[model samples]
Target: MQAQDDFLKRIEKLNEIGIALSSEKDTNRLLETILLGAKELTNADAGTLYSATEDGQLKFEIIRTDSLGIAMGGTTGVPINFPTLPLYKNDQPNLQMIAAYAAIKGETVNVPDAYEAEGFDFSGTRAFDQKTGYRSQSFLTVPLKNHENDLIGVLQLINAKNLGDNQIRAFTIEDQQLAESLASQAAIALTNQRLINDLKKLFEAFIQAIANAIDDKSPYTGGHCHRVPVLAEMLADAASRSDYGELAAFKLTEEQMYELKIAAWLHDCGKVTTPTEVVDKATKLETIFDRVHLVDHRFEVLKRDAKIAMLEAKLAAMQGGDAEHAAQLEAEYNDKIAQLDDDREFIRTANIGGEFMSDEHQERVRAIAKHAYVNEQGEDAPFLSDDEVYNLNIARGTITKEEREIINHHVVATIKMLSAIPFPNHLKCVPEIAGNHHETLIGTGYPNGLTKDQMSVQARIMAIADVFEALTARDRPYKEGKTLSQALKILGFMKKDQHVDADLFQVFIDDKVFLRYAEEYLDPKQIDDVDPAKIPGYDVGA
Candidate 1:
């Protein structure tokens, strides 16, 4: 009756330990808790947990003992060579070893008389028991089973003490039952931990897939989203290695690095809302189709009209029998066609040059509008309207202020879309990181109009990377891509205007990060003409 009461108390203690394990999600903490509980419940001097390995071997995951001499840190329990033992599931052991026998049989094992059982084999168990200067009398071993009923590990308790003799006593059936109950609880906790880990991995992969999909959306921008993350990582790595005191202080941990990569990939996710036509806008006056082609048709009409006027004048002069008048009319007609052709040539080249409109160019374009025609509807149609000529002649800048707004709204859409995403707790900063790429220190940026204080270093790095990629991308539909030197020059001007961090730009250049990226990912021909010397204070030889 007394033993039964003692068993009940032990079961209550095991239940308390199980409750404690339930609260811990961290794998290391749970393993430690399991070992501590096993030792306490069995009154054992030492305990160890062995997890089954992929190769059908038992590997030690945790080992805890009462001896203060053994250093507990960094030792992952002993590896048992499976070939040396007659270990098979449900098979009996040659030696009456409690732990090994329980593992092989997939059942809890208890030994009540370890030292004085003549028929009981103790070949494998005796050596370790004798070496510890502690007589081993009782042993309790339980096989840890997962939810699938597969053996995950084994929990062993050693040197169970006898209450009356003050010596070790053999483990009883009651002890085996208690150990099995604890093992079952541990298996459930471990299974839950594994599920959580798998879910985390799935979430990360899903985010990466979304980033890849964004990159694959446009042919010209196919690798851009992918490249930004790579560049961001390189910059981060450089910052981490810098000797500069301030930069070194901002070192990124593994988790921060991961978050930064995710943010970088999704930085332009808002571009999805941006119209593809606007993104691929090639011509200055381009809408669905270029209106400049209409201008060419207008020039053709002027040529035809000039010819008809010459014919009319020549016929009237012939009626009056004046040969001189006819010759003069023919020359005048040819001159008008020549002048019109020259004007058309000028417009075509100017439109393609992609240079911003100069005041002189706009004036020339206004002067060409004098050759207006009377349409078949009796409406006077200027070869080009004053406004049409003005916009067409503006040469390289955007065609309309409205189009510029549409282009800039991509930043706004990006912020809105990212804000709607349900990022997990660890990734709560992702929306801020993705949205702040367009922000500046001087509050001159758009969308949220964030200042430097509201922006993180990750955001700043992304902003720089976006600008750099944009300036150097030859595949862009609108402007001719700048040479590397030109891109750097422009970036320098932007820095002077407080659009980007000057020090960070300098660090990025000095670290040769861009050069490394160009070599690895960019076409050699695209960057071949770049002269590092053209960048102020930069030495190509160095």
Candidate 2:
């Protein structure tokens, strides 16, 4: 009855360990759990877990020696200094080493005593025992085989201890059975975990590839796709670590953090649909190419026409012997040239869009458009096309209203694209988080126009990151990257305008996420000192 009860209890523990293994998500923790669970069930004093490597070797993954209190790898941060044991040597399977032999043959090798064991090299184990003044005995080497019958790793436990007397002994047949069962469960768990991780990595790579395609599509946004994720992760991390106020209770699980990061990476994936010409427009009169050059040529034509008329009038005056009229004609021609030069300079300045285009500037553009020039077909036409005047008169930045609309449409397209993807449960919020970066606390933002109350904190964190990256990015086409203080001030104003989450912004400032990211990605020259107290919409006390 006593023996039966002991076996039943061990069976129960085995079931518990199986459940734990299957449920475990993190690879490192899962490995540790498998090794530790196997050791506990078998009552082993020391053990090592070796994962199969692509280079046909058994790599040390986790090592624990209970009696000697030695531990390395698996979140201990102490690296395994031991070299990998080759599974193949001399163009064949390495059967001399017991662990390598187990992995290669896909069989369990239970040696009651290593010193007394035959048919395998125990020199390395003997040396380890000699160096540490420890006795190595009773090895239960189990091969972790996946569903496909392939050996994924080897689990070897050393020095099994008697549960009653605490004396080292050979592993019981029950112990071997339990370890094999656990190894089977662990293999399944590990294989599933690796598959999940590989899929995730492939998915992330696909997302980044899409982002790169978009970034490469527009030369102006060269690194925006890459940098935003770094910034978004930083701010979200800062928000997660905040210990007070609205975000005091806010936190991100490892999965949630990964979701946010993936969201940030795919945030602009919709920009693929955006026209490269509009996205790359650096000057107001830019399209497939800058039309400012065309305008420049037209001004030259006007000047040449003026010179021709002046020379004709002078010749006629000279032939009629009107010397004074000829002299006045020369003065008028010089003044006309001066006026034309001024107009051309104004138009050139207008083409390079910056700041606000005031009413006066718009009027001047319209008036200049009325000037006549010979068209390409040798017919007279307006010096500036009406469309060119409209583009040149853009109130701010380079793109006009229609082009701006086209640009804004990208966020909508991004949402559409991301929503179409069937992300897993943990990642279902990816579309919301990625697409809502353009949204505001108020309803003024684009696409869905989701207000702060309707959006997740992750999305709000994204807004702060996106805006801040834009402000600090040195690679934008419209403007120079702002100084640290200038960026903070602008972000502060955004906070005041209800564009960003005030709580996250305060955390962003208080935690100095900006400084952390700036040190890494910002231009060294743009890294000016920031005085947080003067930030426009920030609450220093809060």
Candidate 3:
């Protein structure tokens, strides 16, 4: 009755260990647990856990020796310095070693003592015993195979001690059976962990590929997709570490951080559907080509016409007043050419989409569009087309009202695209976090116009990241990237206008997250002096 009770108690302990193995999430911790649990169950003095490598090698992953007080690899943080043992030497299996032989044959090898064991090379074991001044004996080597019957690795134990008298003894048949059962459970748990890790890698790769595609679609946005995630993470991590304000109590688990990273990478995925011409537009009159060139051609035509008319008038004047009238005709022609050149320069300047197109500028564009010039067919046509005038009159940036709407549609598309996919429970908020990057804090932004109250802190963090990257990015040809002070001042104004989250912005400044990112990604020229006292909407006293 006493023997049966001990056996039943060991079986219950094995079940508890199995439950612990299944719940472990970290690979190193899980491996450590498996080896430690095995050692505890068998009362082994020392053990080594060897994992099979893809290159036909047995790599020592975990090592434990109780009497020597030595622990290496796994969660110990001390690397296993020993070289891996090859599973195959030359063209055949390396069956001389006990661990390799057990892995190859899928059988448990029970040796009463290393000194008395046969059919195996114990030279390395003997050398180790000599160096450590410890006697090596009673080996139990078991092969670990997964549910698919594929050999995962080998578990080797040395010097099993009898529980009654603490005497070194060979493992019993019952000990072998229990070890085999625990090895089987450990194999399944390790396999499941590897599968989960591989799936996570695959998912991350898929999203990154999409981001690269979006970036590759437009020359101006070449590195925007890659850089935003870095900044987003920097800011989010700083916010987590903040010790004051709304973010003081904010925290994120490892899983939450991963979800935020995924959202940042896929935030602009909707840009894939946006037209490359619009995204790449550097001038207001740009489409398939810059229509400003067409306007330039019209100016050249007007100059040529003026020269022709002047020569004709000179011919008539030469007959009546000889040299004087002919010279005056030439002067008039030169004056007309000068006026045409000035108007052409003005129109060229307006086409750049820089300054605010005031009423005076609009009037100038309309007046230029109304001037008649002779076409190739000898018919009168406006010097500037109505479409060209309308495009040149865009208030700011290369994007017009219509093209701006088209660009804004990308955020809506992002929401729709992300919503269509069924994300796992951990990542269910990705769509919301990514989709609300463009949303303002005051309900003035596009798409759903979600305010700060309606959005998550992650979405707000993304908004700041997107805006900051845009302000400082040198890739866009339409405008020069802002200096550090200029960008921060603009961001400050944005906070004042309630366009962005104030708490995160404060965290951004206090933590100096912008400086950390700028040193890595910004040009030296873009880095300039920043004064906190002068920064708008920022409380320097705080």
Candidate 4:
């Protein structure tokens, strides 16, 4: 009957240890569980678990004791070294005795009185008991070993209780057996927790590396990805403050804001695949190479031919004694070349601005396109083909239709790439936030052609930011950078046309959000002499 009760008690202790180990995957929490279980199994007033360092030195991972006031509050961990104790090596008699005869060795060491133990060393244990107020009647230590028989740590239990005397008593064989069993479970849990921590660190490093790669791609465009997130956050903050009718309208939390910032940084990640020439398109009708310059030279040739023809006709007419008529023809030919030169100069200057041509500019451009020139074959040629003339006359934007299609495809590529990434649950919105930037409320946008109803607040903010930045950017090769006043004027026109959110633009201007951002982010030279108040209908508050 007593044997059955002992077996049942050991099983109960083992069950408790299992529950403790499985409660947490954290390494620190697992160590605490080991200490608590060790104390309970051995009926000790105090218990500690010491994990070995890479250098073979032991560090106290956890400490628990009834007398220690609920696990020492802040004294959970300590170093186990010479000042603490002379730890035993495997060859040491004390260590061997514990390993060979204690419950860890599949036997049990019943030390009735540790100070009087005949076959084991008790000096270290006795000294520890004397330093504290605790009396040591028994000392039980177990090795926490994993399935591979590798030692993970050591568990030490002190002052086994005597039920009859209601005082500290010697450790029993059953107590030793119980502690060893608990230690074994702790080893497995600790190993598993370490593995989890390592994997998490690796994943975080990978994410940081990807962001850095994106940042490093273009030298002139440095910090572009970094700044987008910051601006996105500011916009989101402003949006949330404004009174939108629906409470459930998409509002960013701190975590959501962080995710959106990450998404902003990665929004142009697909640009990696786009040719650098396209990204830095610096000339009118520039492709891999510019062909417009050739057209300009052809026009110059036609002007030269026209002058030579007029001179020849004058010589012929003078031969017939019509001197006044010949001179008039020469004067008219000179005037034509002068006008053609002026138009050519305007075309060259116009390409330098990199801005989309306005309707008035396009009309002027079509007139220039109709001007005749001489080809290399010396035949009469219009300055451009019919299609080229049509394209030049459209005045839709700086980008040609083909170039616009390529630029628009980036949004599609962004969505595809981001969707394939296995983002964490908190960052699941990355793809949506990135891909939806080009979308508009009026269904005129590209990639997905998503309407306003399909767009989120984040998407709208991104669109505004993209357009504003492009308008104000000075480094672009093709177009002259707009002054702040000019850029705002354009934005105002866009708002009036219902292309952008007027309310948000009003809020942006009234709050001086752009000025605030420019102070921190724009170069001092870029901000010089810029007057925010000069913007049309500038309001301090909207």
Top TM-score model: 3
Deviation from native of the Cα of residue 193 in model 3, angstroms: 0.9
| Candidate 2 global lDDT | 0.91
For all predicted structures, in order, the TM-scores are: 0.67, 0.97, 0.97, 0.61
For each candidate, what is the lDDT?
A: 0.73, 0.91, 0.90, 0.67
**Candidate 1: stretches off by over 4 Å:** 1-220, 353-355, 376-378, 385-387, 393-399, 528-534, 537-542
lDDT of 1 by residue, 173-239 (tens): 6666677788889989988887888897887687678777766666656677877888888887777
Clash count, predicted structure 2: 0
Kindly list the per-residue Cα lDDT of model 2 for residues 320-429, writing each as its tens digit. 99999999999998998898889989988888887688999999999999887887799989888889989989989888888989999999999999889989899999
Candidate 2 TM-score, C-alpha based: 0.97
Candidate 1 local accuracy as lDDT?
A: 0.73
TM-score of 3: 0.97
Error of 3 at 464 (Å): 0.4
Which pairs clash in model 3?
A: none
**Candidate 4 ranges with C-alpha deviation above 4 Å:** 1-223, 236-255, 270-278, 310-330, 353-360, 394-397, 421-424, 442-444, 449-461, 464-472, 480-516, 528-542
Q: Rank the candidates by lDDT, best first.
A: 2, 3, 1, 4
Name the top lDDT candidate: 2
Query: Which digits, one per residue and each the tens of the lDDT, describe model 4 over residues 181-258?
Result: 776677788777767678767765665566566556544455566666666677667766765334236467777876
Q: What global local distance difference test value does model 3 have?
A: 0.90
